[model samples]
Target: RHGMRLDAADQAWHLSTPTPYDPPLTYGGWNQCRALGMRIASLLDAREQESNAGSGHSDNGTKRKKKKHKVVIHTSPFLRCLQTSVAISAGMAQFEAPKDRTSSSRPRTPSQMHSASPKLPLGSQKRYRKTKLRVDAFLGEWLNPQYFDHITPPPPSSMMVATAKAELLQTEEVDTFTPTTTQRTSGGSLWNGANNRAGSSRESPLDDWSHVTNALLHAPIARRDRSNSASSVGSNESSGRKSPFRPKSPFRHGHGFQPLTSTMPKVEASTYYPPQPHYAISNSDTIPRGYISHARVNTVNVDYHWDSSRHLQEWGDGGQFGEEWSSMHRRFRRGLNGVMEWYSQHGSEERGEDALGLEQVMTHESTDDDDQEDLVVIMVTHGAGCNALIGALTNQPVLMDVGMASLTMAVRKE
Candidate 1:
């Protein structure tokens, strides 16, 4: 009942024997995520009120700027995870929607530009502008052949991208109009063309994401081709095998369904290799049957500015055949570091004005007087991945099985 969005019989079948097809969240999962989103909103609302009450007066004799509460959602590119984010965004929107602001009721701070409505009908749901959700490859489920009886074929980047938009379109009135050249070009170049300053002293994991994000947003198949060609050129001269290490995909997973290359013995071109997963996904494939239409495309509400690098993927050379426990720790540590960087940039008053588009950034210097508000980051991933993230942040293993749509918080005190 809590797994994939399949019929009771099919769901049971999948539970016993997992399928290769990427499944969307169950109806129950959607509702759970929305409730979780509301809880988060309530927590943030309380914190904001407390912060406002604590500040007495400004030393400058002038009114202080009102702080705008910001929430950024980073989610796995998997169908279920993306759907979870959409539902969470909807929940937050519903919670924050002002109730009778025109009357005597106290107005909700960080007012919503969207109309106040408890439930948004499908195909007409308005976009929740206050929260920005991004699909992050690093947050994807652990991908190693040894974990399962059969390796799950990774979904194509385009299909994942398309499926995300389709889900948003049905549940949240996303812009389904054709994308402009600027919108497409901007997203594509940010990742493929950005410089990776891995060696720089001040460099953060954020610098390595432009390429991966670009692939996620636009021309992923093309990027795959380029990556393959580049790898071929750098093949080991002695053995004539592609280099096990690829700078673009420092980690084994996340970059779509391209052939994997490692120090392990390579399968002969003539030898038949069983399709690792029960089914193989190609560029022409669509979302699982009965899922939303994978035709819509939205670039506005989903930010592509800061995606995680393939370097942070769950498995790689660090963890031979599969991802070792230590590799999982390192993976989440790097992911946490990158997320902290995102939090810092977003929390700062100097965040790029362009990046604040559509997001509510209330800062009235006239009547408002408060310090900067705290920023909230919602990360969507698998249950075990949740444990890994908790392990990374807390430096202790709770060894508990994380439930579906469960929220585990780690507050940063500075």
Candidate 2:
């Protein structure tokens, strides 16, 4: 779980450290993730069969070589997501490779496997070891200042990898409680009565993150100086009565979306007035929700309900608060595009690995075969990032209410 700081008066709203699952995931949650993994595995198996069928033997009786399919999984830097990805990976391992491929010596049914836990079958482990899992920092939860009551930084990369490994270890043997040994002994339990309940109920013990490298660090807190605040530019008392130019509205879409330009100045929220108790103001003229008033209206606060300092920190000194929206869109779009490009390039000719360090193996395409190469890319991210991904894939800016552990699938059109 992540936390946020929403104190508007506090300019440098800091992001807290990520917290592990309090009670830990229920059995049902584990089952759902495992099912998703199984589904993905099944889909890949079917695709392999299609490829094999389409590729007829050469002039000799020898079988034609099939393209090597690589499965790349990208996950958010969050602890919970990393845990879920491990479960899904284990579930995928449960699938037996095709019999004709000489990968599986014997077939094992559901009853023969340990479906109750996230453990991979002994044989299946070796079969899918090459499946790559990488943490993509951009895939972390959305950094919308207005939406969060408390903002938490992502887990360090090493810690995240360790958590995933720990989750995987849990499936090695059956246990009533899924939390690690450290988690079990660290804190008090929910039931504090006659039974003298054990195990941690709130926070899990912190891991030794000293050696953790590649920590996914977010924007640093901005300065608290009010002189540098956007409001100062408007308050020019030398000869001015009032600056006619107002700051642009921060909303990305709908009633008050005033686009930002090079000439426009940034705006900071001065005060926030909570909604009034009374609904009607008898004879008084009231502005409708989401509507902006035009008559010398200094009431428009671009940083309304938003921690503009966070955005400023992310974008640097001269950047506007709303700039984060476009930046995020570009980040996600590039990531998705890179994944597709990697897939397309690796399917045919071999090339040197990219900056991401993903190993690209060469594969020969059958001249007579007309079928396209298959690629499986799994992205485990937070709800907001998921929405951003959807927006990027569809080339439309959208905001969707996404919940925990929700799954979204997108297919690129040929």
Best of the candidates, TM-score: 1
lDDT of 1 at 116: 64
lDDT of each: 0.53, 0.45
| Minimal lDDT window, size 10, model 2 | 300-309
Candidate 2, residues 244-358: lDDT per residue as tens digits? 5555432112123244455344343222221222343321222222111110022111111111112211211111223376676776666677656656665322223232433
lDDT of predicted model 1: 0.53
Distance from true position, residue 350, model 2, in Å? Answer: 10
lDDT digits (tens) for residues 204-284 of candidate 1: 333345566656677533323435655355444335655645444532233322454655443322111111223444322
**Position 395, candidate 2: lDDT:** 78
Instruction: Quantify how close model 1 is to the true structure by its C-alpha RMSD in Å.
Output: 24.0
